[model samples]
Structures are given as C-alpha cells and as structure tokens.
Target chain A: MYAAIDIGGTKIAAGLVDSGGELLARHEHPTPAEEPVTAVEALLGRLMADPRWERVRAVGIGSAGPIDAAKGTISPVNIPAWRDFPLVARVAEATDRPVTLAGDGVAMAAGEHWRGAARGRENALCMVVSTGVGGGLILGGRLRPGPSGNAGHIGHMCVELDGPPCPCGSRGCLEVVASGTAIAARVGSTSAIEVAEAARAGDAAALASFDLSAKALAAAIAGTAALVDIETAVIGGGVSKAGDLLFGPLREHLKEYARLSFTRDVTVQTAALGGDAGLIGAAALVGHAEV
Target chain B: MYAAIDIGGTKIAAGLVDSGGELLARHEHPTPAEEPVTAVEALLGRLMADPRWERVRAVGIGSAGPIDAAKGTISPVNIPAWRDFPLVARVAEATDRPVTLAGDGVAMAAGEHWRGAARGRENALCMVVSTGVGGGLILGGRLRPGPSGNAGHIGHMCVELDGPPCPCGSRGCLEVVASGTAIAARVGSTSAIEVAEAARAGDAAALASFDLSAKALAAAIAGTAALVDIETAVIGGGVSKAGDLLFGPLREHLKEYARLSFTRDVTVQTAALGGDAGLIGAAALVGHAEV
Candidate 1:
C-alpha cells in the first residue's frame, strides 16, 4: 500500500491507496485556513499517524500550485502561510518514507490516466474546471510535469485575445471564462449551482452564460490540440457536474474551433473519478514511477 | 554523411550532409508544378544519382503537408498532382536508401534544435512564418510529432476569438493573420517582401500590418507556452527577416498574452540557419535518432 496526501486550500486529505487504485482507508479534516504553516503540517502529521500508514511503502503528495517538484517545494495561491514551503521535506520528516510530489492538476491527470477516463490513452489533456480551472497532461504515454512541475496549468492559457482581463494578468484566460466562478459571475448568480438551476428553469441568460463559457473552453482545447496534438480531453470538477448542460454546448463549440483534420475528431469525455481524483492521482505519482 | 531532400510547392532541394551539420554538396531544381506525380519522382531520382550519393549512409526527406509520414505518403495542399503519393517508397526505390520522413516544419525545428538557436534547450518551439506559418516542437529533449507526425501545426491555431475567418475553416488562424501572405493582403502590397521594405521606409499601413501580424503570432506563441510550458521560441522564414520590426512587437504582445508566472518572460529568438534549415533538419531526423 502507498500513502497519498491531497493538500488544498480548504482541506487536507490522506488515504491508504492500494495497487488497484482503491483507497483502503481515507480521512480528511478542514484546513485551518487562517492559521500559520505549522497548523497545516500538524493536520498532515495527525493523518500520517493513522495506523494504516505503517503499511505504506512510500508517500505521494498532490498540492496546489505553483509547485517546484525539482526543489520539492510548493507556493499554492490559495494557501497564504506557505511560500516556497518545503512540503516534500516536511512530509518526509512526518512519514519517514520516500515522498513524491506534483501539482494537484498533474496528480489529477495521473489518476485519470492510471484508472479513470484517460486510461489507455498515450496522449491526453485532463482538466478540472472548478473554482479556478487547472489541468495536467499525459504526453507520449507519461505525465509531463515540465521543468517546474507545472506542465498542464491550462487555466491560465489565454484563449480570447482581446477578451476581458483576468486576475492571472492575462486577458481572457480560460479560468476567467470557463471556470465555475466565471459561470456564476456572468450574471451574478452567486453560485454556479444556482446558475445551473436557473438554466434548468429555462432562464435564457443562464443558458447563454454556459454557452459562452463552453465556447471559451473549446477555443483553448482546440488551440491545445493544434500545438500539442492531443485527441482526447478529460474534464472534471464541480462545474463539469452540470453534465449535458455544459457538455452539450462544449461539444458543439469544439466542432467550431477544433477544425483541423487531426484535431476535429478529438474526443471530450467527463472524468470518471470524482472528488477523490486528487488523492488517487497523488498515489499514482509513486505507482507510475515504480513501473 | 547523410542525404537530405526538401520538397515544397515551388522547389525540390537535395543535399549531402556531414556529421557536423555541414552541407557538403547541394543542388536544387524548380518544381515542375504543372506536371504529373511521375515528373516529381523523376526529379528526385535525378538528384539521388549525384556522385555524392555514394557516401551517404541514410536519407531523410522533409515534405509539404498534410503528409502521412507513417504511410510514407503526401497530400500537400499546394501539390495537387500528388494526393497521398508514395514519395517515401519511390525515394527509397530511387536510391535504395533507408529513408526517414517528417513535415517541413518538424524538420526545420529538428535542424535548429540540433545545432541552431534551439540548441541546448530541452523544450522549445521552432517556427517558419513564410507564405504560411508552420512549426515544430521539442518536448523533454525529443521531437514530438504526435500520432500523425504533424504534432506542431501551429499555423491553424486560432488566436482571435471573434477575429477573421481563415481558409482552413477556422476563424482567426495564426496563418491567416501572421503569414507572409496575410501581411501582403492586409496592406494591399504586391508581396510581403515589398511590405517589409515599405515598413522600413516608414509606410504607416505597412507598419500597422506588421504590428497586427506580430500581435497574432504573439498570441499563438503565448497560448502555446501556456499549454506546453515552453520558454523559448525560435522563428525563421520570410516574415522573420523583418527582425526587430517583428520581434519587438511580438515580445511586447507576448507579455500581454503570456501573463502567468511560468509563461511570462518567454524568450523569443531568430532562427540561426538560413535557407537550408529544412535540409539540415531532415538530416537531423536521422542524426538525432542515431544519438
């Protein structure tokens, strides 16, 4: 068994992952968001202290960006206390096991590539379109974490050249257009969940927002296909749960944008694994390395 | 020594290349454009009959696309006489040599990556922005040709969300905005060469056209950086000869589009090799494989 940890802004999760992509024992606790760096490490320590960790051969961590896997540190935007924090070293000290780290997006892609929607695909782009969109890549049959371990940060890719400015410093970033937050803010619905409900109730404005978001996503996906030559894109996260409401328009727009012969046939599929994608993918970082 | 062939719409070039990226013997023939497929093959046969061919251990060919490199066939848009023509087999039959094939863009990139501007860089993009914009990629220190061997077809990547339509059935394709053909058409110039001269002479419309083209190229480059995590882009061909007139605006616009921490400050450089980029790159396809 391998121990997997998924670190995010709101929560810290730990699991005992088996070879079959199963989480034998899983635990989670709310993150003390306003606390200092030690508070988060303390939560990780408590989780590792669980008796199941003794059976683990190695530890894998999937943290939010911007992670430097080579340096074994992370500077996640959501977590303020940790700036270039040595999460890998801390985890190593806590677990006394070899620890592997990758950005959360890359970990999620690894999980999908190993046992989820991207399974059996040699080249794919797996994305999570939630509060802030993020992604990971599987190219030439392996996860490409790039030099900085941020190979698939697709959220920040600018699709609309003259589109609205994004907080990421680019104009018309995919996250600013297609993310759940973007979808909710399009018409001030307060939440994407509410927007989905409004769409279900035949609100033309709500439906239009989803359509607009899908169009931006299609442009980015198409551009990615043109550059990197991918035939499959796997999308997950809260906004994706809207199902056909979002997917219906996404596929339609994809046809318009992915017009090249090699790109036109690219298949877009929903991510099979749910919330645990981050945790399972973290485990896959080690699993895949061993192979 | 290796034998290299570069086939395009207007010319067919042949060269004998040494291990040090030198072109020992070189010759070219204007393409008999209005002739049959046999005429093109005969030209290739005549070139291989050169006394220099005796020392060549392998052969490489870079052809216009859309080429099915795996099938050794080509269906170039400009070469209507040959639709999926068996150029690879015919070349092999003509010279009895082990042949390797790649798109012209990939060949140019491989050439530059092996010994030119992209040298010493693990991840880079090499592009040719002549009549049309074409490109190739080096990812994790290897050429990525994708499943179709057309992995870096950057010309068709749309940068403008609501921009102009392109001949490739896509809206705002990079080629439609940044190619030499686009530049000439944008300013009603007889040729891009003339447009460049006019810009140097302080023609307002010509200057604006170049700026527009630079903006589009920058958008595509920025988008590519965001997707693939590349920090360097090497540009060549007709339009690139404009130097700072193009590079200055491109770098400026890139900063606007490639705004993320990882993507910002992407370095743009000019191609080192001149007209022979395709030939040397074709040889590199074999040279790199041997290493």
Candidate 2:
C-alpha cells in the first residue's frame, strides 16, 4: 500500500492506493496558508488519523513550483509561506516512511501515463486547466521534471508576445490566456465555471472569450509540438470541463499554425483521470523509481 | 574513430573524430540544390574519399527537419527534392557502417555536452544562431530528442503575438526575430556577417535590429527557464559571433522578464566547440541509441 498526497494552494488531498491503481481510502482538508509548518502539521494529523496510513510503506507529495526535486524543497509562488520549505523531510518525519517529491504537473503526467488518458502513449504532455494552467511532460517514455523540477511549467511559455502582462512579468503566457483565472478575468466573472456556463448558453461575449483562450492555447501547443515532436496532449483540470466550447477553436488554430507535417498530425485530448490523477500519480512513483 | 557530418542548406561538412573529441580530419563542400539524390551522392563520394573513412567505426548525420528519425527519413523544407528520403539507409549503404541520425541542434548539444562549453553540466540548452535559429537540450545527463528526435526546436516558440508571420505560418516565433535571417531581413543586408559588422561599427539601424532580436530571444529564454528550470544556455553558430551585440541585451531582457527567483539565475554563455560539433556528436553515438 502507498499514500499519495496532492498539495494545492487551496486544499490538501490524501489517498491510500493499491498496486493495481485502485484507491482504497481518500480524504481532503483545507490547506493552512498561514504557515508552512502549520499546514504540514495539520496534514500529518489527518494522515495519522486515517486507518490506512498504518499499512502504507511509502509516501509521495506533489506541489506547485519552483521546486528543488533533488533536495525535496519547495518554494511555490502561489503559496508564499512555503518558501524554502523542506516539504519531503517534514512529511517523512511525520509519516515514518520513504518519501518522494515532484512538482504537481509532473505527478499528473506520471499518473496519466501509468493509467489514465496517456496510458498507451509514449510521448505526451498533460496539462491542468484549473485556477492556473500547469503542465507536465512524458517524453520518450520518461518523465522530464527539468533541473529544478520545472520542465513542465508550460503555463509560463509566452504565447502572445504582446497580448497581456502576466504575473510572471512575461507577456501573453498560456496561463494569462487559457487558464481559469484568465477566463474569469476576460468574462468579468468570479469563477471559470461561470464563464463556461455562460458560453454554453451561447453568450457571445463569453463564447468569444473562450475562443480567444482556446486559440492562444492551440498556438502554444502547436509551437510545443514543433519543439518536442510530441503527437498528443492530454488536458485536465476544472476548465477543461468546458469541452467543445474550448476544443473547436483550439483545433482550428492548431491547424492554422502547424507547418511541419509531423507537428500538424499532433492530437489534443482531454485527460481521463480527472481530479484523481494527482493522487494516483503520486503513488506511481514508488514503482516508477525502480524502473 | 568516428565520422560526423553536418548537412546544411548551403553546405555539407564532414569530420573525423577521435575518442578525445579532436578533429583528426575535416572536409567541406557546397550542398547541391539541383536534386536530393545527386546532392547526397556527391557528398557521400567526397566523404568516402577521406583517409579517415577507412578507420571510422560509426557515422552520424545531422540535417534540417522535419525528419522521421525512427524511420531514418528526411523531408527538409529547404531541400525540396529530399521529400521522404531514406537518409540513414543510403548513408549506411555508402559507408558500410552503422549510422545514427539527429537534428542539427541535437548533435550540437551532444558535442557541447561531451567536450565543449557544457562539459560539466548535467542539464543545459545549446542554441545555434545561424541563417535560421535552432536548439537542442541535455537533461539529467542525457540527450532529449523527443519522440521524433526533434525535442529542442525552440526557435519556433512564439515570442511575439503581433510579430511578423513566420514561414512556418506562426506569428512572432523567436526564429522570426533572432535568427541571422531575421536580422538580415530587418537591416536589408545580404548576410548576417554584414549586419554584425554594421552593429560593431555603431550603425544605428543595425544596432537597433540586433537589440530587438536580442530582447525577443532573451524573453523567450526567460520563458523557457521558467518551464524547464535549466541552469545554462550555451549559444553557438554564426550569429552568436556577434558576442555582446546579442548577449548583453539578452541578459538585460532576461532580468526584466524573469519573475521567478529560480529562473532569474539561468546563465547564458557561448558554445565552446566552434565548428566540429556536428561530426563529434555523430561519432559519440557509436555505442548509443535513442534516449
């Protein structure tokens, strides 16, 4: 048995996983943003209280970056209190088990590659379209986390050289155009779901916003396909639930920009694991490391 | 002994390499644009005439894309006659040796990582600034050529949403701004060397053109650093000879656009191997397979 944890800016989710990719137990709690230590303590309390924790031999934690995977440290910009936090050590101390660390996106890719949408694919990219856009890569059947565990941070890849100024100080990053936050900002809505629903109802303003976002995403993906030569992209997260409202324009833009024959053949699909990908991917590390 | 060959749009270069990365013998010939088979055959004839060919154990060929590395076929856009050409088989038939194929940029990265500028680095990006811009990646001490051996085609990444349209049909690609071709076009010059000389001589037009190119290149690199978290980028090829004319502004732009603390620390440097990288990298693959 293995324990997998997905640490997000808003919440902490833990799950007990078996060898065959089944979830035996699951729990969630609000993440403590006040302090990194306090948050870990709260998570540890929850894990220890669970009966399944006693049988798990290893633990995997996935969080937002920029992270130092080698040192198991994280300094996520979204969660300021985690600066230089020894996340792996803290979790290990609390759980009394071997621990592995990775960025949330990388974990998601691993999960998808092992049992989700990318199960049979050799080269693929998995992206999360939640509050923010995040990405992970599986190239040549290996997970690429880069030197500082930022290899799959596709949200920051500049898509619109002149579109809009992003929080990262770059202009027109994918995150600025295609993410949930970007959708909300563009439609003057409080959440991405609101924009999705509005577009579904044939609202011109909302549909245009979705179209623009999807086009930007498609352009970025086409460029990425040129760079990495990957044939498939697996998209997940809350915003991906918008479905055809986003995919139609995305396909059209991809065809418009893709010049290389190999890149033109690339396919984009929605992720199959949904929200459970993070948990399953974290658990997959126990077996993947041995390979 | 190893044989490395760089097949470019304008020229073909062959070098005999030793285990220590020294070029024991070298040869060059203008690439024939009349027909694909004839051009390849002519190059092969010259390469076979070299004394080093007798002792060479393996062959490596680097060419323009879009290539099918697994199938050993090439279909470079500039070489219109080479559509779906079986490059590896023909080369192997002529030389009676095993051949490995990679993109020009990937070969350059391998050469640099093995014995040049990136010798000690485990993760780095090698960029070639020539008639066209191209890139290659080294991650976790291994060459990453992606599924079709086209992993580091960074030049095509969109850097400006409103920038000029690229031959690839994308707008604002890095190649459309930072390549020697782009620089020449901007200055109405015949070649990159002329633009570089004019910039060195304090020509306002030339300097401005380079400045714009450098800023775009730097912004793109900053975005890549945020995604891949690499430590250094080793630059090579003809345009890189401009030195500070390109790098100084590139560094400034990187700092301006870099929002994450980790990305701000990425170092950009010149490639150590001047011209023999292609052949050396090809030879490096004598005992290796795609990774």
Candidate 3:
C-alpha cells in the first residue's frame, strides 16, 4: 500500500492506496488558511491513526507549487504561511517511511498517466483548469515533473505577447485568460459555475466569455504541442465541468492555432479521475522514480 | 567515427566525423532548389569517397523540418518537391549502415549539448535564430527529440494569440516576430544583417526593431522556461550575431517575464558551435538513442 497526501489551499487530504490504484481509506480536513503547516501535520496524524498506515511502504506528497523537489520544499501561491516549507523531510520524519514529493501538477499528471485518460499515451499534457490553470507533462511515456517539479506549469506560459498583465508578473499568461477565475471575470460573474449556469440559459455574454477563455487555452495548448510535440491534452477541474461550453470552443480554436503538420492532429479529452486525481497521483509518485 | 549529413533548402552538406565529434573530411553541393534529393545523393557519394569513410560505423542526417522521424521521411517547407520523401531509407541503402534522422533543430541541440554552450547543462534550450527561428531541447541531461522529433520547434510556438499570421497558418508565432526576417521587416531593411549594420551605426529604427524582436524572443524563452523548467537558453544563427543588440533587451525583458521562482534565473548564452552545430549535431544523433 502507498500513503498519499495532497496539500491544497482549502483542504488537506490523505489516503491509503493499493498497488492497483485503489483508495482503501481516506481523510480530509479544512486547511488552516493562515497556518497550513499545522493543518498538514494534524491531517497526517489522522491518516496514520488508521490501521492501514502500518501497511504503507512509501509516502508520496503532492503540494501546490512552486515546489523544489531537489530541496524537498514547497511554496504554494495560495498558502502564504508555507513559503519554502520543507514538506518531504517533515513528512518522512512523521511517517517513518521513505517519501517522495512532487508538485500538484506533476501529481495530477502521474495519476492520469497511471490510470486515467492519459493512460497508454506516450506524450500528453494533463491540466487542472480551476481558479488557476495547472498542469503536468508525460514525455517519452513517463510523467516528467521536471528538475524543480514544475515541468507542466502551463498556466504561466505567455499566449499573447500584448494581451494582459498576469499576477504572476508576466503578461498574457494562459491562466489570466483560461482559468475559472478569468472566465468569471470575463462575464462579470461571481464564479465560473455561475457563468456556466448563465450560459446554459443562453446568455450571450457568458458564452462569449467561455469562448474567449477557450481561445486562450487553445493557443497555449497548441504552443505547447509545437514545443514538445504532444498530441493529446487531458483537461479537468471546475471550469472543465462546463463540458461542451468549454471543449467545443477549445476544439474550434485549437484548429486555428495548431496549424503545423506535427501539431495539426492534436486532440483534447476530459480528465476521467476528477477530484480524486490529486490523491491518486500523490500515491503514484511513490513509484514514478522507476519510470 | 560517424557520417553526418545536413540538408538545408540551399545546401546539402555531408561530413565524416570522429567519435570525438571532429569533422575529418567534408563535401557540399548547392541544392537543385527544385530537385534536392539528387543533390543529397551526390553529396553523400562525395563524402563517402574520402578514405575516412571506412572508419564510419553509423550515419546521421539532420534536415529542414517538419520531418517525420518515425516514418524516416522529410517534407521541408522550403523544398516542396520532397514531400514525404524517404530520405532515411535511401541513405541507409546507399551507405549500408544503420541510419538515424532528426530535425535540424534537434541536431543543433544535440551538438551543443555534446560540446558547445549547453555541454554541462542538464536542461537547456539551444536555438538557431536566423531567417526562421528554430530550436531543440535538452531535458534530464539528455537531448529530447520528442515523439515526432520536433520537440524543440520553438519558432512555431505562439507568443501572441492575436499577433500576426504566419505562413504555417498560426498567429503570433515566435518566428513571425523574432526571426531575422521579422526583424528586418520591422526596419524596412532587406535583411537582418543590414538591420544590424544600421543599429551598429546608431539608427533608432534599427535599434527599436532589434528590441522588439528581443522582447518577443524573451517572452517565448521565458514561457518555455515556465513550461519545462529550463534555466539556460543557447542561441545561434545570424540574428544572434547582433550580440548585445539582441541579448541586452532580451535579458531586460526576461526579468519582466520570468518572474516565477523556478523560472526567474533563466540565462541566455550565445551558442558556441555556430554554423557547424548542424553537422556535429547530426553526428551526435548516431549516439543519441543510447541516451
């Protein structure tokens, strides 16, 4: 069995997963917004209390990044109190087992590549298009977390040279135009879910907002395809739940941007694992080193 | 020893290279423009006529792309007559040695990673920024040719979603804005060399043109860094000869674009191999499979 932990802005989740990618036990706790480290420790304690913890051979932790896998540290954007936190060392000390670490994006890709839509794909980009867009890459049939564990940080790539300024200090980043936050901001809606509801009701403003986000996503995806020669992209998260509202326009815009011969046949697919992906991916990271 | 061939739109050059990547003997011929295959065969025959050919154990060919390494075929954009031409099969038949094929960009990167600016770097981007921009990537201490061998085709990556139309049918590609052709067009000059001369003479328009191209290049480089976590970018080709006329502005803009912690330290260096990168890189391809 593998022990998995997922550190996010709002929640700390832990689970015990078997070799077959099955989650046998799980636990979750709301993240202490101002003090996430303490919450992580508490969540770890709760998970260890389960009898299955003794069966765990390795522990894998997936945290929002920028993570330094070499240094075993993480500094998630939404968690102000955890800048450069030594996650791997602390977790290994607490669990008393060998530990592996990866960025959330990397974890997500690992999970999908191991058992989700990206399974059997030699090269793919798996993405989480939530409040902010996040992603990981599978290259040469292996999940590549990159040296710093940020190989698939596609959200920050500049899709527009002169589009708009992003909070990450770059202009025209894909996240600024394609994330759920961006989609809501485009239609002046409170949330992407609300915008989706409006679009379902035939609201032109909401539909156009989704289209704009899709256009930016298409450009970024096509650009990635050109750079790495990936032919498939698996998308998940709240914004992706909008279904055809996003994929339809995304596919349409992809046709326009992915015009190069190698990139022309690029395909988009919905992520199959949903919210469980982070936990499943964290578990998969325990074995990823062999790949 | 290895045999290397570089097939460009205007020239077909072949060389005998030692295991240490030293070019022993070489031959070249201008491409027939409309009948490049014949020129390539003639160049290969001349290269084999050298006594050094007896020492060669393998052959590597780097050609203008988009090349289908899987199919052992080439369909260069500039050489329309060679669509899906089976260059690898023909070369292998003539040479009677195992043959390897890669895009020119991949060859350039392999050469640089083997003996040039990117020699010791674990992850790097090696580029040829000429009339058209091209590049290849080194990841995890090895060159990655990607599935179709176009992994480092950075020129086609869109920096601007709504920028300008490229002949490849994409808008705002890095090549559309940062290629030597683009730089010269910005200054109403016939060539980037002429623009460089004018900029050296303190022409304001020429200086602005270089800056604009540098800014685009900086954005694309930063974007690539964010996507793949590469810290070093080695640039070659005619436009890179502009020196600080290009590097100064690129470094300045990189500071504004590469703001993420993992991407913040991206360093740009001039490619050390120069024009011979393609040849040496083609030679490098013979051993890339083992990596």
Candidate 4:
C-alpha cells in the first residue's frame, strides 16, 4: 500500500491505497488553511495514525497549483500559507519513504486512467470543474504531467481570442467561462450548488448559465481532441455533479466544434471515483512512474 | 539512402535522402493536378530515374491531407485526381522497397525536429503557413503523429470562439485567419506574394493584414503551448517569407496571450530547411516509427 495525500482548498485528505488502486483505509482533516505550515504538517501526522500507515511503502502527494513538482514545492491558490512549501521533503522525512508529487489535475487523470472512467483507454483527458477548473492528460497510455507538471490545464487555454480577461493575465480562458465559479457568478449565485438547484427548479437564467458553461467546456474538449487526439474525457468535481444538466448540452456543443473525423469520435463520461480520485491517483504516482 | 516524395497542391517533388537527412538528388514536376492518376505515377517514375535510385532502401511519401497514413492513401485537396490514392503500395511495387506515409504537416515537423531550427528542442511545433496553415508536433523528444496522423493540426484548432465560420465546418480556425491564403484574400490580392510585397512597401492595409494574421498565429501558438507544453514553434511557407513583418507581430501578440509562465517562455523561429522539410520528414517516417 502507498500513503496518499490529496490537498485541496476545502480540506486535506489522506489514505492508504493498495496495489489494486482501492483505498484500504482513510482519514480526513480540515485544512488549517490560513495557519502556518506546521498546522498542515500536524494534520498529516494525524492522518498517518491510521493502523494501515505501517503498510505504506511510499508517499505520494497531489496538490493544487501552481506547483513545482520538480522542486517538491507547491503554492496552491487557496492555500496561502504554503507558498512554495517543501511538502515532499517534509512528507519524506516523516514517512521515511520515497515521495512523488504532481498537480491535482494530473493526479485526477492518473486515477481515472488507472481504474475509473478512463480505464482501458490509451489517450484521454480528465478534468475537474469546481471552484477552479483543472485538467490532466493521458497520452499513448501514460499520464503526461509535462515538464512543469501542468500539461493538461484545459481550463486556462483560451478558446475565445478576445472574449474576457482572465485572472491568469490572459483573456478568454475556459476557466473564466466554464468553471463552477464562472457558472455561479453568471447565475448570480454564491455557489455552483445553488445554480444546480435553480436549474433543477427549471429557472431560465440558471438553465442558460449551465448551457453557456457546457458550451465552453465542450469547445475546450473539442480543441483538446483536435490537438492531442484524446479518445475520451472523464469529467468530475462540483460542476459535474450537475449531471445531465451539464452533460447533455456539453455533448451537443461538442458536435458543433468537433467537426473533424478524428475529433468527432471522442467520447465523454463522468468520472467514476467521486471525490477520492486524487487520493488514488497520488498513490499510483508512488510506483507507477508513467502516471 | 531513402526515396522521399512530397506531394502538394502545385507540384510533385521527389528526392533521394541520406541517413543524415541530406538530399542527394532531386526532381520536381508540376502536378498534372487535373490529370488522371497515371500522369502523377509517371512523374514519380521519372523522379526515380536518377542514378541515385539504386542506393535507395525505402520510400516515404508526405502528401497534403486529409491522408490515411495507416491505409497508405492520400486525398490531397488540390490533387483531386488522386482521391484515396494508393501512393504507398504503388511506390513499394515500383521501387521494390518498403514505403511509409505521413501527412505533409507531420513530415515538415519531423524534418525540422530532426535537422532544422527545432533540432534540439524535444517539444516543438513546426508549421507551414502558405496557401493554408498546417502543423505537426514533436513531443517528449520524438514526433507524435497521433492516431490518424493529424495530432498537430494547429491551424484547425479554434482560437476565437465566434470569430468566423471556417470551410472545415468549424469557427475561427487559425488557418482561416492566419494562412497566406487568408492574408492574400484580406489584402484583395490573388497571391500571398503580392500582399508581402505591398506590406514591404509600407501599404497600411497590407500591414494590418499581416498583423491580424500574426495575432491569430500567436494566439494559436500560445494556446498550443498552454495545452501541450511546446518549447518552440518553427514556422515556414510563403507567409513566413515576409520575415519580421510576420514574426515581429507574432512575438508581440504572443506576449499578449501567452501570460502563463510555461507558455511565456516559448520561442518562435523561422524554418531553416525551407521547402525541403517535407521531403526529409517523409524519409524520417520510413524508419522512425514515432514520426
């Protein structure tokens, strides 16, 4: 088994995952998001206290970006307290085991490719559309983390040349139009859940917001299919929880942009691992070098 | 030595290539583009009539797409007489040598990656922006031709969500906005050459046309960098012949779009092998399976 750590904005989750990619045991703790580095480290210490800790052969961490996996550091957007934090060295010191690091997007892709929606597919893209949008690539049957560990940032890719200015300093990023945050803002809601609820209640404004987000996501997916030849896309996170409300139009809009013979054949499916995909993917990074 | 065939809209060019990617001897025949398939085959026979043919061990053909490299067929847009032409099997039969096939764009990219401006860059995009824009990818130190050999069709990848409807049935493709054909059409010229000369003479309309094209190209380049992590882009073809007139604005506009750290570092360079890149890349396709 490997000890896996999944760091996100809301919380820090850890688990022991077996070779078959099943979580053997798990623990979770609220992130001391604004506290010093030691608080998070202490949370990790608490996570490893599970009886299965001794069975872990390696430590794998999947953190939000912008992360420098090569430098074993992360400066996730929401985790202001961990600026370029030396998480890998700290984890290695505590576990006395080899540690692997990758962006949360990459970890989600690896997890889906290993045992979830992308299983058996050699080339795929896995994405999360929550508070922020993130993505990862599976190419030629392997997880492509890229040099800076940001290969599948489908959200940041600009589909609209002059559509809208993005916080990444670019204009018309997919994240600006398709992310859960974008959906919430467009629908005049504080959360994606509220938008989903409004849409379920058949509110016209809410429906339009979901459709617009779906269209942007579809365009990004089609563009990715054209560029990299992905055969499938596994989508997850808060926005995907909207289910068919987001997916039906996403499939329809994909046809509008995916005109080429190759791109037209791509398939879309919801991620199967739910919230624990990051944990499982982090574990795979420990020994599955390609992932 | 290998036999290399570069099939394009205007002509059929064949040459003998050495192991080091050097062209030993060559022959060019204006495409009997409107004639029957037999006329083109005759041109290939004449091309191989060079005494250097005896040294050729394999044959490679790079044709304008949409090509089915797997089925060994070409359906070049201008060469309508050769729809789904069995060029590979016919070449093998005539030369008694193994034959390989790739799209013209893939061939150009492979050629550049092997011996030109992209020689040392493991992750690069090589493009041709003449009558139409086309591109190919070099990923992880080798050419990635994708499933149907159209992985790097950067020209077709949408950059502007609602810019314009392209003939390829998509909207705002890089090709429609940035190709030499587009430049010529925008400047009310029959050819890109006239547009270039007009721009060199400080014609305001011609200069703006080039700038628009450059911006489109830059956006496509930046988007590709964001999606695929390309380190460099080597551009060729007639529009590229305008030199700084095209590249100057391309670099400038790239800065406006490539705001992400990984994409900002990407460099753009002119193609070194000029027109011969396709022939050499076709030859590489024979033995380098990745290409």
lDDT of 1 by residue, B179-282 (tens): 99999998888788899899999999999999989988887887777778887999999999999989999999988888766778689999999988989998
Q: How far off is residue A24 in model 1, in Å?
A: 1.8
The better-scoring model by TM-score among 3 and 4 is 3
lDDT of 2: 0.80
For candidate 1, list the clashing residue pairs, or say none: none
* Residues A1-291 of candidate 2: C-alpha lDDT, one tens digit per residue: 888888887887888888788877777777777875675576667767887777888987778777787888988877887888898898888888998888888889888888898887878888888888888887778777676665778888777656688887777788898898888898799998898888888899898888877877887787777777787988898988888888888888778776666688888999988778888988876656546
Q: Comparing 2 and 3 by TM-score, which wins?
A: 3
In terms of TM-score, which candidate is strongest? 3
What's candidate 3's DockQ score? 0.86
Q: Which candidate gets the maximum DockQ versus the true structure? A: 3
- What candidate 1 gets wrong by more than 4 Å, as runs, is B34-36
Stretches of candidate 2 above 4 Å error?
Answer: A49-51, B46-52, B285-291
What digit string (tens of lDDT, one per residue) describes model 3 on residues B58-80?
A: 99989999999999999999888
How would you encode candidate 4's per-residue C-alpha lDDT over A1-291 as one tens digit per residue?
888888887788888899899997777777775664555567568757877677778888888887777788888877788888888888888778888898898889988888899998989999999887888998888888877777788878777877788888888889999888899898779998999899999999999999989988887888888777889889999899999999999999888888876688888999999978989988877755633
Worst 10 residues of 3 chain B by lDDT: B31-40
Angstrom error at residue A213, model 4: 1.8
lDDT of 4 by residue, B133-236 (tens): 88888888888778777778777877777767887787877888899888989878998789888999999999999999998888788878877788999999
Candidate number of the best lDDT: 3
Per-residue alpha-carbon lDDT of model 3 for A1-291, expressed as tens digits?
A: 999999898898999999999988788988787767787788788878988778889998889888899999999888888888888899889889998998898899999999899999999999999999999999989888888988899999988777689988888889998999998998888899999999989999999999999998998899899889897999998999999999999999999999887999999999999889989999999878655
Q: Give the residue spans of candidate 4 off by over 4 A.
A: A34-36, A47-51, B34-36
Off by over 4 Å in 3: none
Docking quality of model 2: it rates as medium
- Which RMSD values do the candidates have, in order? 1.9, 2.1, 1.0, 2.2
